[model samples]
Target chain A: MPLFFDLLGVFFFAVSGSLLAARRGFDIVGSFLLAGMTGFGGGIVRDLILGVVPTAFVNPFYFIPPAIATLLVYFVAPGVQRLVRPLLIFDAAGLALFCTSGTIKALEAGMNPFSATLLGVTSAVGGGLIRDVIANKTPSIFDPHDIYAVPAMMGSGLIAMLWMLGIRGWTWELGVTAVVFALRILSLKLDWRVPKAVGPWHHDTQLR
Target chain B: MPLFFDLLGVFFFAVSGSLLAARRGFDIVGSFLLAGMTGFGGGIVRDLILGVVPTAFVNPFYFIPPAIATLLVYFVAPGVQRLVRPLLIFDAAGLALFCTSGTIKALEAGMNPFSATLLGVTSAVGGGLIRDVIANKTPSIFDPHDIYAVPAMMGSGLIAMLWMLGIRGWTWELGVTAVVFALRILSLKLDWRVPKAVGPWHHDTQLR
Candidate 1:
């Protein structure tokens, strides 16, 4: 079950990356590379911070899904790009799952709850952050209007709380996932956005 | 002596990152954060790939130089920016040192010579890559015009070859460093630029 969800997360992220690359009209190799980066980037960062080699390089299973997704997207670009509804569902599930799993791994790495929870959000969002940066744009998450990291943080925080309370079980994990998944769904449906900072300080910041 | 060069590398990288952030008009905190990222990003990636925790978080010495650099940049923006001539020399030295050290570390981690050499280039270039991406620009090294990563790879590959030949010592490391440093200096002096990939695929890339 865990592996199933992990693969699902990889698949969704890879597809998103493929879609972005296609929108930018990148070549086949670029699309494949972007898909692989998106699928594995967050996990790689999470593992790195936890002081482990990236699982994607070590395990073929972690790499194959992205390769497959990239091939599929390359072959059927328009069709895959248009599958927005299913993609949204899968992406929301992925966001939640990665946050919980990333937090758990950080906790295992001996990180404190606060740091673990933050790392959980980093795990969930870091892939796309990297993807956008490489694609030559400001990261969407840093825009302050994106709710992506917020949902991940909320869920990861809850997981941390549960672990601190010694309530360790699959039940809490599932509940946390559901909460983030629901929050993501709602945020999209409601068109929610975080308020942007204003003023000259935000405009042209001076060191002194 | 290695530690001394290592700190010098971090300080140079941190100053460069802060300069970039200041150019982008980012806030004080953003400057500090970017400085930290540039100083530690490559080592973190190198350590993670080597299956070790980030030395920056483990050792304060690895981090303090960046903090100091940020503060220094913050206070003396125009003065520091004007010091680019000396900074370039320090940066070149850092690049060579990092590539040699990074490759040696990868070799120590049991990676093959080819992989170790590649990781060496990554360690030398990765920090600047992250800094540029966060500053919302394409990486200068990726521009092909920049001889940055090329020289690093050359130095690192030499380090790996020296290791293979069982010629391990400071003399060889110094020789490798001289090779990269001289290459960088010559590239700048000769106005060398790698020929751009000139297909339709490369057209829309901004700042090309």
Candidate 2:
């Protein structure tokens, strides 16, 4: 059941990636590659950091989601072009699951609580970061207008704190996921934003 | 001796990364962070894929070069503003060393030759890719105006082929490094470039 949810998360992430590629006017190869990378890049990086083989590399089934996502996006893009809200909802769900799972895995691997939380946030946001980077755009996490990573950080930090306090179980994990999902969706709907750089600092003070 | 060379490569890569950060008008924190990421990002990613702890994470000494690079760029930007040529030279040197070392490390870890070659190229270009992405720019490897990854590919492929043919030694490794370095330098000097999408293809035919 967990693996099924994980695959669903992968599918959702891949769909977002392919949609971005289509918007960027990339070809089919680009759509497929981006979908795959966006689906698996976070887990691959997380696994690598944990000194384990990436599940995507080991399981053939992991490849199916991205392929399906690419095809779906390519074929139905014209009709599904304005499904931004649905996409954001799916992305939020993926983020919730990934942050929880990543934190749990890192904690199980005996990473320090702080590091585990960091890794958790990475797992949640890393795929979108990779996708935006590949598409040559500012990552939403870095964009002050978006509160994307904050919810993941909050959820991961909460998980780490709970683990430290000896509270660990599926119920706790599920609760954390729900909290993160709600936070993300609410932030998006309410147009919540984080503040950018403050004080008297010129943007072009360094290079020019 | 190899460790020393590796550190030198890291330093060169960090300098290039810091230079880019400065050019992008990032503040001190951005400079340091970008420098650190570019310095060790490749080796860290390679180590992760090879299922080993990243040297950057384990070794405190590995952090020195990026710190120095950030300090150097931050302090000297006014006087050394037009060091693009020197920066490219340093970047090329780093590229040469990283590609060869990455391939050798993969082979030593018992990865197959093709995978080894891919890892090699990734090591050579990963840092720059990360840096560019963070700065919200197109990765140079994907830019048709630059032939950046070609030399790394050539070097990594040659190294893989040689290893498969049972030809392995420091001398061969050094020879391959020289070949890749020269290729990169010459390509830059001659303004050589890879061709963009050639066939009849519209750039903005998909999304809008």
Q: What is the DockQ of each candidate?
A: 0.13, 0.15
lDDT of 2 by residue, B78-185 (tens): 433475666688788889999999999999999999999999999999888887778776776776655799999999999999999999988898899999999998
Return the interface RMSD of model 1. Answer: 6.6
**Number of colliding residue pairs in model 1:** 0
Candidates' chain B TM-scores in the order shown = 0.85, 0.89
TM values, all candidates: 0.59, 0.61
True contacts kept of each: 0.16, 0.20
Per-residue alpha-carbon lDDT of candidate 2 for residues A1-208, written as tens digits (9 for 90 to 100): 6677678778888988888887788988899899888889889878888888888988899989999998998677666558566567767887888898889888999877867876787788888778877788766555444578778989999999999999999889999999999998888878886432211233345334
In model 1, residue pairs whose N, Cα or C atoms come closer than 3 Å (at least 3 residues apart or on different chains), thus clashing, are none
* Candidate 1: regions farther than 4 A off: A1-40, A48-101, A111-121, A134-136, A141-208, B1-8, B28-37, B44-69, B79-93, B110-115, B133-138, B142-146, B161-167, B170-179, B182-186, B189-208
lDDT of 1 at A60: 81
Looking at candidate 1, what is the lDDT of residue B71? 71
The per-residue C-alpha lDDT of model 1 at residue A207 equals 28
lDDT measured at residue A82 in model 1 versus the true structure, 0 to 100: 72
Q: Which ten residues in a row have the lowest lDDT in candidate 1 chain B?
A: B78-87
After the best TM-score superposition of candidate 2, give how far the Cα of residue B157 lies from its true spot, in angstroms.
17
* Deviation (Å) of A80 in candidate 1: 18
